[model samples]
Target: MTPSISVVIPVFRSRTLLPHLYDRLASVLDGTNAGWELILVDDASNDGTFEAMLALHEKDHRVRVVRFARNMGQHHATLHGIKRSKGDYVLTLDDDLQNPPEEIPAFLAKVDEGYDLVIGKITGDKAHSLSRNIASRTVQFLVGKILGKPKSLSLSSYRCMSRRAAEAMGSYSGAHVYMPALMLGSVPADRICNIPVAHHPRLEGHSQYTPRKLLKLFSYLLVNHSSIPLRFMTIWGTLISVASLGYAGFVLVDVLANGSAVTGWPTLVILISFMSGTILMSMGILGEYIGRLISENARSGQSPVFEEYP
Candidate 1:
């Protein structure tokens, strides 16, 4: 039987919080008149998180578990569960219980209202570090500008997406799996909506989102999702080419009119260095894009499953 909703949670060393998260999700989901299932995806957290997930599956057959062969980050783990979801609506949330499972209904409410994607907007005080908060803001701004998302809507890990929205993400096979960027691209701006949800402090351990991970995600977003970097290089390259031509023309006019060139040889050397650096930078950008393309086309598997329990 198909469930009305499928809850996809990415687990990473959150063994202690699993019991509470499962209980709350079950409790809230049971109240609604909809069939639901829970997908617990372990992002290769070798710290025995899969054991807890298996226990939950034993307790309730509605629970599904998948352990990756290696760590693929939270977004990759989530896309795996979402692909396995057999529900009308695919809901995602943090395993730390920061975004309460109780907020599931609010997201569902918007989904029921025909919204393709319903994201949770953190209301009141957010329980995160300044850097994490800044990263989140930076992601939202970039998504808005690059993906043409509405400024009014916000992005969060806690959200509900319709089956169509989930299916639309099938084209993204690259390693750069930015969930929000893919989602915003899949659904139209008008179809995406946001509802306020309360955010709480962590229940057990620190966030899996470290500074390095955040920067990596940002880098992938810039390179994989948008062509702005290439465009910037192209524009600057053309301008620099024009500037070099103007300088060459100046040297020509000076040699013809007076004696040698213009003034100091340092100016010509500086101009050469500047243009060479820009050319090198542009080549590097093109190489990165080409490398990613090769990686994308030659892809063998995605989120390879090590173990999955019934």
Candidate 2:
């Protein structure tokens, strides 16, 4: 039977937590009215998480597994599940066990309210470092600025999307694919809602979302989703050029008035330094955009799955 709901969890070095997660998911999903399936995408964990996924699949027919050939990022793994899931509505959550399985019903309840996408908003305490929390908020702010999502809308990995919204994402082939950005573009803002969900501390392992990865994600948002960087560079260059021209005019007028070359080592040094910095900054932004374009042209997000379990 085709499942009415599909749960897609992207696993990354959570071997110790898989068994408990599977059991909890089963318990919560068993009472649902609609048929459901668990689709676990192993994001090439160096640990034995893939083996555990295979074991879970063998233990339960509803558990489906996809093992990636290489460690594609979490979003890529989620995209793989989104494309392959055979359910009317798909739910995606992390495998770190921070997002409780019990909240699945709340997400479903929100979806029943006619929203095309219902995100599980983490209202409870998140046991993370101060830096991590700040990074998350920063990313959210940038995403809102670039993708035009509501700054108030707190997006989590745990969200449910209707088939229509999921299908809308199929047309996207960008390398740095942020699922929430694509989702915001695909679904109307009014139709997207959030439900409060409980959050727990990590069960065993630390999060893979290091500071570096969060920065990388931010960079991806800047380069892939918006041209703001390029626009900023253009504006900066124009302003600097105008200022330089004005400064030159001032110097010319001073020389003509005094009948001597306006000579100041400090002024020359400052102008030269400012102009050089502006040029370098503009070049760096342009180079970043060009690099993104080249990567988008060369690489497709369609990662290869080395194995699958039915």
Candidate 3:
């Protein structure tokens, strides 16, 4: 029988928190007295996370584990879990215990209210670094703007989606998978809602998402999710071209009026440098899109290989 809810957690370098998370999650689900399953995807963790997942799975038939051959980022691992889930409603949460299992009831309550997708918006201070918060908010803002998310809607990692929404989202086979972006793009704005959820301080290791990784993530979204960058390049290139032509006309008139046959080397040098830089910048944006296309074409095997499963 299919479970009423499937909780998906992407396990990275979180070996220490697994047992506690499982215990809490088990108690929480058991209290509901509804059929439920837990899907934990080990994202190629070098730590002994896979072994721990195996132990958990061995102890509980409801717990299923998926192991990746290589670290393919959080979105990929979560996508794998979503695909393997047998629940009518799918919930994704971080393994870091920061998003407490205690909040599951609230999420489920909201889900029962007929929202196709419900995101657990963090209420208080998140235990992440300032830089992470800034980067995350920036990404969220851009995603909201590009995806036309409602001003009231704020996407988070801790969220629940109906099975139809999950299946629709899982159908996307793009190499660069931003789960929030994909969800917003696939599902209608009216069907999504945000519920306030408690966020606790992290009880363990450092975050896997470094600033560099965040920057790369933003870059991917910029290139693949929207045509804004290309449009910006177009607008800037046109402005530069028009300004250069005007400058050229000014120089020609100045030389003509002054009756000087010698060209101003400095003016010519500046114009050439400016035009060269613009051309290179435009080419670089095009190259980024082309690179993404090549990657998507070359990509294969969407499912992460399972080391073990129930």
Candidate 4:
């Protein structure tokens, strides 16, 4: 029988917290009195995470587990998990205890109100460090602006979507997987809504998101999800051309008024340097876009799932 809901979580080096997370999910899910399944996608967290997932499966048959042969990143893990789910509704949550499983009902409530996709916006102060918080906000702001999402709608991994939306998002194929981008692009904006949810401190370990990962995520959004780069390059190149023309007229005036363009070498060199820098910058931006295009088209194999619990 198809479960009423499926909870998909991507785990990475988080074995220690799995038991606690599972217990909370099991308790809350039981309270709902709805048939549900927990799908845990271990993203090659070879640090005994698979063993823990298997332990959960042994404890409860409703706990499904799949471990990647190699690290495929969190979003890829989630996409796979959701695809494998057989549920009328799907919830994606972090493995960390920070995203309380208790909040699941709030998301369900919103989804029941005709919302196809309901995101859990963190209420009050977040428990992340200042830098991480800033990075999160920056990414959220960029997503909202680029995706043309409403200011009231915040993006979070702790979100719930209808089975129809989940299947629609499965149509997405890319080398880089940004969940928020995929969610926004796949679902209609009008059907999406956000509700306040409590965010608690981590029980153990720390955030796996390093600065490098955050920057890569930001780059993914900018290059893969937005045409702003090409548009920016166009406007930037046009302005540079106009500047060059203006500089040429200045040099012409200097030559005609002062006999020769000998003293114009300094400004000429400056202009050349500026133009060179702009050209290189534009080329770099174009290269990123082309790289993503080639990547998505040329992208082939992925790390296989070697283990799944019954």
Candidate 5:
């Protein structure tokens, strides 16, 4: 029977949680109206996650396993699973138990309301660190400003997408995959809805993401998804020029009114330093755009190598 829903879980050294996760998912999906299939993408997990998945598949026909040749990022694994899915709707979530399997029904319920996307929003205390929480808030703020939708909600990896939304998202190929930004670009904000989901402490290994990774992800979003930084530079350059002209006028007025030299070497040095810094910053932004173009071209020339599952 064709599955009505495909649940894609990207696994990377998450073997310990698979048994528990699979059990919970199987139990939750048993009573649902929608026929379900689990798409487990093992991103070259060294922890024998592939073996576990194979064992599960042997016992159950609804489980499908796709093993990657090497470790791709979580987004890549997600994309791979989605591409391999054969269901009318797709749900992507972390392999960690933090996103409970029980909440899958809630997501499906929201999807039934005719929304293209349903995101599980984490609110209140959800076992996230203070630093992570602050960083996430900052990312949400910047994403909203850049996308020109101040109210655009921040989306987690735990989301449900209609077939149309899934296919639209699968077409996007970028250096970094910011799902929220991609969804916002491809679908209207009103088409998206959020339901609060239960968050649990990680039952297995630690989080793969670090603070540095978070910053790099944010930088990628800023560079690729929005031109706000470039626009900010333009505005800043104009303001600096106007300020310098005003300073020059003040100096000339002082010279004329008091019959004295208007400045010292210190003033000249400060002006030169300011201009030099501004020039470097402007060049840096240009270089970022150029680098992205070059990278895109390089990626276009090559096919993504993947190891076939045995």
Candidate 6:
């Protein structure tokens, strides 16, 4: 049977949540017009997760398993599954059950309304920690500004993409995966829709992401997807230059008007420090962009080696 929908779930030590997730997914997608296949990418889990997935595959032919050679991050695992999927639409979600499988139909419905992508938006109380929430919101704001999308739209892994969108996204190769931003770059805003979905507390295992990882991901997006950081650096450098000129004029006037030598070493030290710091900061921003370009070109020139399962 040809599957109309391909559901990709990235698994990292998520053995405990499989049973309930499978049950809910089966119930919700059983009678829908769209035929479905679930692709689970095991990110080199050492907790017998691969064995469990093999068992599940034996029990149900619709469930397919792909094992990574190493613990590539969640986004890499997702890309792996996307490459293997044959369905017309692809949906990616977490294995921890934070995103309910019941909402899959709603996402599909939105996608059917001619939208290239439909993202799930969490409404009501958020179950994440305050710091996590803040970090996520900050990412959302920066992503929207950089991508020129509406700030109100939230990007989650629990989203559905049309076949065209999936194909467009499959061409992207990067260590960092901000799917929403990537998709926004390829597809227009009007073609994207946001559907409200209920958020739930995690039923098992701790979140794999930390605040530091969040910041790192944001930095990657800023460096890779947009030049806003460089623009800000340019503006900052101009402002500092203006301020320095103003201060130098003030010092000259003071010296000339009072007929006294300016003898404060501290003021000279502060001015030099500020100016040097600004110059170094601007160079650092430029360095980041140049480094990213170099790395991307290197990766593009190299041939990726893939291992096939027996």
Give each model's whole-structure lDDT: 0.81, 0.80, 0.81, 0.83, 0.77, 0.78
Q: For candidate 5, write residues 186-240 as lDDT tens digits.
A: 6667788888887788975677878877877787677666655665676676566
Task: Give the alpha carbon lDDT tens digit for every residue of 197-307 in model 1.
Answer: 999999878998888889888877777666667667666766666676667667666666875544666457556856775685677568567756744542432322222
RMSD, one per candidate, in order: 6.3, 6.3, 6.0, 6.4, 6.7, 6.2
lDDT of 2 by residue, 1-310 (tens): 9999999998889888999999999999988878999999998888898999999989998999999999878998998888888888899999988888988888888788788899888885467777887887787788787778886688888899887777766556766777877777667888888888888898776789977777777877877666667667766766766676667667656766775544674467457756765685677667667757744552344222222388
TM-score of each: 0.84, 0.84, 0.86, 0.84, 0.78, 0.80
Best by lDDT: 4
lDDT of 3 by residue, 1-310 (tens): 8899899999998888899999999999999999999999999999899999999999998999999999889988998899898888899999999898888888888878888789988896577898888887888789878767787887789999888778877776877877877787667777789999877888877889977778778877877666677667666766766676667667667766875565676477457856765685677667567656644542332322211265
Candidate 1: Cα lDDT at 163 = 84
Predicted candidate 4 versus true structure: per-residue lDDT over 1-310, tens digit per residue? 7799999999999999999999999999999999999999999986899999999999899999998998878889999998888888899999998999998988888889988899888887679999999998898789888867788888788889898888877666666788887777677778898888889999888899999878888878887677667667766766776676567667666666876536667467557856765685676567567756744552332222222389
Model 3 lDDT, full chain set: 0.81
Q: Choose 5 or 6, whichever is better by TM-score.
A: 6
Q: What does the lDDT read for residue 227 in candidate 5?
A: 55
RMSD versus native structure for model 3: 6.0
Model 6 weakest 10-residue run by lDDT: 299-308
lDDT per residue (tens digit) for residues 92-191 in model 6:
8999888989898888888888898898898965678888888878778887777677876778888898887776677666666666556676566778
The parts of candidate 4 lying over 4 Å away from their true place are: 261-310
RMSD of 5: 6.7
Worst 10 residues of 4 by lDDT: 298-307
Prediction 4 TM-score vs. true: 0.84
TM-score of model 3 relative to the true fold?
A: 0.86
